[model samples]
Target: MVHLSRMCTLVALLVALAGCASAPEPQGNSEILNLQAEAEYAYQLALLDQAETLYLEILRSIPNYAPAWFRLGNIYSRTGRLDAAILAFERCVELEPENQKALYNMALVRLKQSHQIISLARRQNGVDPQVQRQIDGLYQALLRLQQHTPTDSN
Candidate 1:
């Protein structure tokens, strides 16, 4: 009887351990959606810094969150972090190839960076070759985007 009881107890313990060992599927999309909503509300309230932080947190949670990436790019651009903004925009484009907003923002960010580079070149005695090359490339890319982007002035 004692042996049978020990066997039953071992079976119960194994079942409990198996249950505990199972991993839960992540609800990444839903959590990111909630974070995005909160970020939007913060932006609407003029809490720019808070919105930026929340957006960054969302990216940290879901690296491939395309909308969060696009928004972060916008926030970074507004805060004058042009390089980071460009990178975030690139990530958004990579994740969502059909995202026109990301593509447009990327073009805009590149244009801003190019202008900054030109200003720096004028201020310095000698322009850095690498910087000049980057600026030229960015300018060309921006022009191409502008040419391709549709106008809706009417």
Candidate 2:
């Protein structure tokens, strides 16, 4: 019984240490900071391709970097890659649930997606009842989001 107790304590300590060991370091590395600056500069300059590449690189080094994910989502949205934009925004929101920017951007991307779907259906000469139902559902969801979102007083 004594040996068993000792083994359990050792395992518990090791597990705790492992959890601490896996904790991420603060994003204070010079290289990461440099990349962040470059990425922001590129984005501001409207060099979306370069911005996307830099943001992706930052994400690879720091998967929990919510800002990088948010920028990536914006880049994807501007390039008309709505699905990818939604996915990137979703990741950002996952990392920072209180991120109003991510949530708002995601809603915008969803609206764009609905527009594309409707346009495509129109170009095909008819909207399937099922597809129309889905589009209506999307509109309803957007309306709900809008109602709940606080308008800027500024």
Candidate 3:
């Protein structure tokens, strides 16, 4: 009778262990959404590198995640990675054409790049008139975007 009781107890322990092991792990859309939320929270906390990592992870899981792409671009822009930021913003725009933040960020990064180019050109012997005109155009575009951005109440 003791041996039988021990065998029953072992079976019960095994069943409990199996139940714990089989607890549902997040997958599919839920996992992706959770990652995206975590990334946004990290960004809000100004943990930009952590946010970038999470955003990239989300992108890997769901390539068309427009908000993550936009936030990643913002983080890159803050870190002065203008080229990378521009590429990310472009991806965001491609994924969601109506993403105003992505459009603004793309214009801002392009303006910054154009300014750098113009400065370099000025330091050199000769500056191209066409290049200067293009820089002026980007500046105008950036100004327009800045004017249109909604002011944050906080």
Estimate TM-scores for all models: 0.59, 0.65, 0.63
Q: lDDT per residue, candidate 2, 1-154, as tens digits?
A: 4335334644553453345546864444546667878998999998999999998997787777777788899889889999998999899778767777778888878777776666565456445888777766766666676577653110
Which residue segments of model 3 deviate by more than 4 Å?
A: 1-30, 125-154
Better of 1 and 3 by TM-score: 3
The TM-score of predicted model 1 comes to 0.59
- What's every prediction's RMSD, in angstroms? 15.7, 12.0, 15.4
TM-score-better candidate, 2 vs 3: 2
lDDT of 3: 0.70
Residue 31 accuracy (lDDT) in model 1: 67
Candidate ranking under TM-score, highest first, comes to: 2, 3, 1
Can you write out model 3's per-residue Cα lDDT over 9-105, one digit (the tens) per residue?
Answer: 4455345334555576434545665676798789899899999999899778667666667788888888989999889889977876766657766
Checking candidate 3 for backbone clashes, the offending pairs are none
Give the best candidate by TM-score: 2
Output the TM-score of candidate 2. Answer: 0.65
**What local distance difference test score does each model get?**
0.68, 0.73, 0.70
| Candidate ordering by lDDT (highest first) | 2, 3, 1
lDDT of 1 by residue, 1-154 (tens): 4335334544553453344445653455446566767997987676879998998897686566666677778888878898998888899778767666677777777766766766565456446888667656666666676577653110
List runs of model 2 lying over 4 Å from the truth.
Answer: 1-28, 127-154
